[model samples]
Target: MSEHKPYTYVTASIHEGVTRFDVSFCTSEMSAKAFGGDGERPFLTLSSTEAHMTVTTTGGGPVTEQDVTLAREIFTASARYLANCERLHAEQPVNPTDQTTPSGEVAA
Candidate 1:
């Protein structure tokens, strides 16, 4: 088996020493223009609007079993990571005044 090259699908530019991220999912837009007519559909689409990423499998052969397994693993890992982040944030103080600084100073 050959090692697959790492590809960067998304990027963010830093400004004012801060890289802010606005997390949001695309509200699935469906129209007649979208593909799907049940004939010879040949490509797998993996899209993430938040990251502005749209990856598609293009080739003569179909995706291998390993590819499906890897995709499932990726989905599981991503879901877990998002859940963990939400859980951590949910545990934070609800009020800004309840927040504290690194020096044990409470926010005013």
Candidate 2:
């Protein structure tokens, strides 16, 4: 509930991909490597080339090990949960969005 406790989150939609991150309560901008949105994988993964963390918070360098660790844990856990949900979803049969006819056309 603190006005300046430390940070916040950003959900951005990129063409052909997605970018999600945590930003400290700063007037400037920042970026970070996040997981849980890679379409190829049911979940997400982070690595040196796969992802990165960028901070442009006007003199906000030296990101701590704890910060990166925390973000990794959070995103990984989320991805795991999503994978489980997708598994469950796949078990169900696909339902027709609307009634169909023998001609493979929508029925009135």
- Candidate 1: where is the Cα deviation over 4 Å? 1-51, 58-61, 99-108
Q: Which candidate has the highest lDDT of all?
A: 1
lDDT of each residue in 1-108, candidate 1, tens digit only = 254543324446689999965434433431112232365433334444334432223343455676567557867987997799786666655555568644455544
- Give the true-structure RMSD of model 2: 16.3
TM-score (C-alpha) between model 2 and the true structure: 0.31
TM-score against native, each model: 0.40, 0.31
**Which regions of candidate 2 fall more than 4 Å away from where they truly are?**
1-61, 96-108
lDDT of 2 by residue, 64-88 (tens): 5665676578779869977997865
Candidate 1 accuracy as lDDT = 0.50
Error of 2 at 6 (Å): 29
What C-alpha lDDT does candidate 2 achieve relative to the native structure? 0.45
Clashing pairs in 2: none
